[model samples]
Structures are given as C-alpha cells and as structure tokens.
Target: MKLQTQVPLNKATNQIDYSSQLVVLGSCFANNIGDKLAYYKFRALQNPFGILFHPLAIENLISRAIQQKQYTEEEVFFLNERWQCYDAHSDLSSVRKEELLGSLNSGLLETKLWIAKASHVFITLGTAWTYQLKESGKEVANCHKVPQMVFKKQLLSIDRIVQGLKDMLHLIQAVNTKVKIVLTVSPVRHLKDGFVENQQSKAHLISAVHQIIKTGNATYFPSYELMMDELRDYRFYGNDLVHPNDLAVNYIWEKFKTVWISETSYKTMDEVAAIQKGLDHRPFSQESEKHKEFLKTLGNKITNLQKEYPFMKF
Candidate 1:
C-alpha cells in the first residue's frame, strides 16, 4: 500500500537543462529553490530585487523592470537613519542613500535583462494580504519596520490577484514571448495573520494561481499541496511550525526536479552535486598527505567540469 498520497505531476514540456537560463522571483520559498539550482550550478538569477511576499508586489517589480523604470530619490525616504525604498525588501535598505539608489537601479537593469533571456521564470506567491501606504495610496512590498499607523492592511480579492498575475504575464511575454512560467504557492504559514486569516489568504492565492494556470500561459506546481498533504507531520516544519525545515525543502526540491528538470541533465546534475559536496568537505588534517591528495582530486574535478561549462563558479 502507498504510505503517502503523492501529487500527480507530469513532466513539463519545456524542461530545464543545464543550458537553460532561469530567473526565480517572489517569496522566500523562491530563495530555497533558487539556491538549489545555484548549488547544482545552473545559470539562475533569483530575486534580484528581494524577497517579495505577495503577488501584487511581485507584479509591481516585474512591471517596473520590464519598463526599465528608475527608482527616483523621492521614492525613497530616510527612516531610522537609513534610506529605504517602499518597493523593496528591508535587506536592500542601506545606511547610505546613494548606495541604495545605485543598487536598486542596477538590480532593475539586471532583472530586466535576465527575464528577457530566461527560459523559465519561477514565481512563488506567499500571501494575498498586502500593505498599502496610506499617504501615496501605493502598495508597498515591504513596510521596513515603519509604524503600523502609516500603512493600511488589505486582503486582495481573487479577482485583483488574478488580474495582477495576468498583467505580470503580459508584461513578461511582451519582452520575451516564449518564456515559460512556473508558479507555486509557498507552503510557509503566515500565522501572524491569525490562523483563519492565513488560510483565507492562501485560498485567495491558490484560486488566482489556478485561474492563471488554466490560461496555458503558465504551469502550476503543487508545492503547497506537497507540504500540506504528503509531508503533513510537524517534523517537516521548522521550530516556528511555520516554514518547512531543510528536510522538507529537500523533499520538495527532489519532487520538483523529477517534473521540471530535464531527464538528460540528471547525470550532469549528479556530477555537479558531487563537486559541490567535495568543495564543502572539511578536512581535519589539512597538512596530511591524504588531505592534500583529496584537494588535488577536487581541483581536477572542478577543472574538468569548468572545461565543459565555462560559466560555472565554485
């Protein structure tokens, strides 16, 4: 008998191989998958702007990037002695104003170029709730620790979410008509929104995503279902019981590889994984002959792989 009810996933028609260029953007779960691709030495650019939680925020960023819009000085403000842009994550906030501006502008250009050439763009939606700045009536990606009074919290309707995703798809296809989009809802629970509210938020996201998927402009991955169903135990969760632990992430990633990644690239991926594991190995006897031999072997492996794929970096 089957121990777990597995989500039935078909192999993607547009499979990702080592040659494919990828751009992953959206929630923190995007980071998890992006890092895995990076670890496997795939050419991937992930969340250049930062970790955006909601679909509208993600759409806003993608729209701006496609338009090559520059972030002006007026768009950012000094808060707690640091310069912050409401459109970006707190990690992009900087102590120096010029540094923040340069970074934002550079990131926009990079992201625009990446999307235009990317074979696959993975977008993970985290929630349907968003915060709008009351003064400008603009939806902000991150509040940046601003006082709660300055922002109005709102739950986006399914219609609005669907429209935003469609807009994002249009914007992307306008630049790169053939790009394949893989959309997934993040499994990380936002219990801070209250359990019931969190469920409502996820429901809105799930509904909107499925609508978009039906358009054939994108494909849907059952990441949320995988976590909620197959790995339903608390052991799969982090200490907060919100985010998936490392093991859970790995499990989901393995499932993703089977469906989304090209079968022909499996051997290459294994080779890459071996090289990565070797690089990560810590030797207790750095001066020993055995350790020196291991280093030589590792160097040879890197050299051989780099010969085949010149773009790879350790």
Candidate 2:
C-alpha cells in the first residue's frame, strides 16, 4: 500500500493521484521530479519562465500574483544567460527537457503571478551547507562566478530556513490558497563537506524541515528519508560513494510520480475552464495588484472575449 500520513503543517499524505498544474523549485531533485511528471503525461509544467536556483524567485513570483497577466513561459527570463541544475556532475540528463523553459520573469513580481496560477508547488531543499560571499555576506546559489575558496563551508542556520519557509508559505497563500506546497529535503550527500560533516548537514536540513512537516499539513514530502532509507545502500551509490547513480534518480522519480500525478487529485473542470477561457491572458500587467484584478476581470470577461474577439481564442 502507498504510505500516507497527516500532520500539522502537512495535513495529509498518501500517493498524490491525478494530473496537476504544478511547478517545481529548489534543489536539483526538482529537475528529476519534473521529468517524471512529463513522462507520465501529466499536466505538470517545469519552470514556466526558466531556471530558478535561488529563493529570490519565490519573492518575485508572489509579487506579481495580483496582477492580471497570464504566467507563460515567454514572460520569465533568467538571471544568468543560461539556466541549469547540475554541472555535468548530475546523473540524469535531459537535453530536451532543459530546452523547454525560457527564463525567469522580471524580478519577483511576475514570478509570483505565475505561481499564483499554479495548482501545486513542490520544493526540494538540496543542502544545508552553502557558501556565503564575504563581500556581500549573502548566501549564493550556484556560485558560478563566485570563487569557491573565497567562501567558507558553513551550515545555514535552522532559524533562517524556518523563517524562509514561513515567508514562502505566506506568499503562496496570498496568491492562491488552493495552491498546495510539498516540501522535500534532498538526500544527495555533499562530498566536499567532509564525510562526517556531510551527514550532519543532511541531518540538519531534514530535522529543520521535519519540525514543520510533521504537523500534518500538505507542506512536505519525505524525499530525504526516502533516499536515505531506500537508496543509501552501497550498491546504489556511484563510484564516489556520494551521489547516487541514474538508477537512484529514476527510482525516486517513480515515487514522486505516484504522489504528484495521482488519479483522484486531477485538475477539476473549473480549473480547466478557467485556463481554457483565457483568464491568464494579461495584456496590461503593470503592478502586482493590477495583475490580480486582471485575472478576475478576465474570468468575468472570458465568455465576452470569446464573442467579441473570436480569433483570439487560444
């Protein structure tokens, strides 16, 4: 039987059945999760705008929620020239999947709007350890331009992680209370963080996220434990004994597939009607609140638009 649980922050759990208008962010695991959903012919969409490797995108997406513009792949542009998850280091690779998205929108504003329209947002927190720039003292994701040695190996404080999660929840609620969030802690060990320290880092992330997840809301997924328990065996790991091989990603993805694409939780007619009716089209999205009203107005005008602009039906 599929494992199911209900807690405070995460109220219910079991295999998620049916199709969902979902978006994924955080951690490299999201890439795998997105791929599996598509493989199963679900309504899941990878980052509409593009690659988002940082939390700032969370804030940006919420800021644009109230504006009445449709969140499409064309609107969002990436911060860097290119968007990616792993450096050739990851086990799974999908050239076709990588090309499907364009980039993030302008700042947090548009990103929030897209998220508001999404039915589900699944987040995977990859690591507790991050490199903070000495100059800005800010934690950097990717560290592409930032020198590795200039940064010191340190764990993000649990307090910060909790606060970030709380803020994100509020942001998500503001856009669409119906939009549920599933949080997960990635189990891939950090080979560079020392053997013992890597375990400590994983423990830190899992414990902090679990503190909220165990409450029984729809806010978390047991990705960390799933990996540690099911794929932690020596045979499952790669030669480095750090990262899991393609088989591991594939296995975890199958489990994620069962949860996000459940048969019963499929999108309802109302949601489809809204999208089909072109409620997401925002020809004039200036401010965040403006976009919010636009969607509402579009809902009101959906049928009228069909009658008036028959050619615009898309």
Q: Which predicted model would earn the best lDDT?
A: 1
Off by over 4 Å in 1: none
CA error at residue 88 for candidate 2, angstroms? 17
Q: Count the backbone clashes (under 3 Å) in each candidate.
A: 0, 39
Number of the top TM-score candidate? 1
Q: What are the per-residue Cα lDDT tens digits for candidate 1 across 1-314?
A: 87898788888898999899999999999999999999999999999878999998899889989898999999999999999998899889899999999999999999999999999999999999999989889999999899999999999999999999999999999999999998999999999999999999999999999999999999999999999999999999999899999999999999999999999999989999998899889989899999999999989999998999999999
The regions of model 2 sitting more than 4 angstroms off are 1-19, 47-110, 214-217, 264-314
Q: How accurate is candidate 2 locally (lDDT)?
A: 0.56
Worst 10 residues of 2 by lDDT: 85-94
> What C-alpha RMSD separates each model from the true structure?
0.9, 13.4
TM-score of each: 0.98, 0.61
Local error of candidate 2 at 11, Å? Answer: 12
Q: Candidate 1 versus the native: TM-score?
A: 0.98
